[model samples]
Target: MPRSLAARIVQDPSDGFRHLPHLHTQAPDLHVSFDVLGGGRIRARMAGPAVPALRGTEHKADLGARPDEVHGASARLCARWKERFVDFQPVDDQGRALRDRQRPFATVADLTAAPEHELRAVVADLVRGGASLLFDTLLRGDDVQTAVFRSYLRSALSQQGLRIRFDSDLHLPWPMLCVAADPSAGKASLDTLFARFLGHRHQIEHTGDAYAWIGTPRTTQSQPVVSLNHDVRVGRTTKADAVAKVLADGTLCTVRTTYEELIRDFEQPHLDEQLMYFWCHGEFVGNAPEPPVLAIRLTDGTPFDGHTVRELRADYRHSSFRPLVLLNACYAGLAGASADRSFLSRMLIEHGAQGVLGPLIAMPQAFAAEYALEFITRYLRADANAGRITHDLARHFAAQYRNPLAFTYGLHGGMDAQLERANGGEA
Candidate 1:
């Protein structure tokens, strides 16, 4: 990590920490409640320094009952997004482009040279579509929830370190929900309002857990793990090289070739890695009616998903180390509209992954590669907190490529997660 691009951009002379309030801290915390009322009903509630009144709202949405409708709406939304915003040739989870790759424009050169208006158009379209889906469909008729959330924002006094812990089953894209949007004001995305909205299965009793560990693990010096499944088709080899270059030395102890091997390696003694990175393709398997399972590629080019990962995770359930997993897989960050814990991201969390950074939908290999390089490079060079690193990488890529797909990647863990490598970690 000889002061790479991300390092040079983010590192400072005084301290490695950049001290962006939004990225560095999780302050002015708000408690959000979304309880299951049985029969596809949900009760949304809010409380904090912002919501002293302690109010809540209820809504009806049964993913199991209306699976087709929910799935169809999601598909339509994603399709429209792709049609409007995708500029570069995007490969599916198998690294195959839906259309011919040799077209008017496909490479990174074409992407960088694309006009600013084109980028702005993509952002504008994304904001509009995302806002419509969130408000008109997801939060429909839930005026109290919106009003309470707005009040929470007002009470924060524009502080950027707002952390709203969502304890609900409605896997809503809380990060994308717009607080305020004015095209003339250049405020298109809601990411600027808060660092992140923490989510989980149950309530968070203490604020300290949101940033730092509430209880110490038995092992503190355990090295992190990097599992880069081999995939020459989509240029994953280069991506893996980038990660290995950064996490060199003994900072990364277990660099496995396959998912099974990675799990086996972790089973060995003195191999409790605190952090793990997965670089491969991921997709949703299974048809409608039954929720889709997240399928990810292995070193042998075989794909495995949430069910397989969950089985392996059980092997480490009693282990003290709760690793932070970085998933470069497409749809690795997506959560369906249900309480079901089958999605890859949620499954990892349930299986003791401290948190996960992944994409909410399918991602372009080029974009995913660049984002990974930037994130790992910054993390190694600046030692910035993981949440901050995610936001920074997405923001930097969005600005550089004028691609709103950067917003697809998000931090799904404690807002205060900081991943520090062993003494000699280099990117």
Candidate 2:
């Protein structure tokens, strides 16, 4: 009684409708399609009767019909298709289709319906195979209500490792590179949260611009230039004591140097530390004269946005403490042409950083602080006697905050053991 996927797509060909590959429908007039674009990305398009044009317009139909009607129908149709086709088969390392026998849908669904740990394994397998699932939901409500529901749907799908891309002529398409992290609604101070989470007094450095620090020190041996508003004397005392205590507790001690300090230190080669932690504001410039500079904040609250991946590769190609860099900035993952790794994580790993952890979306200050504190706590407090502890720590952090659109976590290094350990021996 229901039209086939392809037929539904053909009936309501919205703008750029010819691009998708699979289509299905529950009703004759309504339909949805699954389009496999390049880069292993997939999109869904849903269409039905065109709404009537506004007063004095040419098109004629029921403008009174809500947009959700179309969207809801599409979602229902796609969910059924996913239920029908959601089986698993083995594939090669390259994600190429292999000759493995297809398993039963009930088994896969049962796995998904299992506990979170089991569901994660199944989802990881799907991602590793370069396959993305899509759901097209039709809505019958005001545009505003529809938008709210769409956001909810996006959040739901992202938790399942699926990114939601909405298509509609009524609204402008969301930016391709932009991902939204839900902010903690209200007037909560991120600074206070950071202090509570870290269990220590900290300073806030607000640099107006973004930049990368090249050949910088991991920690500052000199006294920090404390802000005046937050009781400079007390802050300095807290920082000094915290630094000494952390170092005394067998944690590695490193200094965060300013651009000038880094330049001078690099020339003299004085400090001797293997691992480093860089905490600063950063920005990703895609089409700049020098692409993808990790902007570091200076002591005077100024941003020094200079230094490229190429320069780092050429200069610190062999530095022992090339220092794994974690960029706490927006769009830090997107890299430019000519660079094998554009994302800050990949760039840092290639440029000598042992590992990196950063958000793939615009991170809210509170979330960033929380995530950073957790990572540092794990790294500093966890026993390092085991193999690949750091990598596992990073993966665990990512899994906990897995939101494909609002937040994507990535890791790159030569340490396969670390990655595997992080995966918890699953997948």
Candidate 1: tens digits of C-alpha lDDT, residues 43-106: 5455566445533532223222233344345455555555655544446689887574532122
Off by over 4 Å in 2: 1-249, 266-274, 286-294, 301-316, 334-347, 382-407, 414-427
Best candidate, lDDT: 1
Using TM-score as the measure, the top candidate is 1
**Per-prediction TM-score, please?**
0.70, 0.36
> Model-by-model lDDT, in order?
0.53, 0.32
Error of 1 at 338 (Å): 3.6
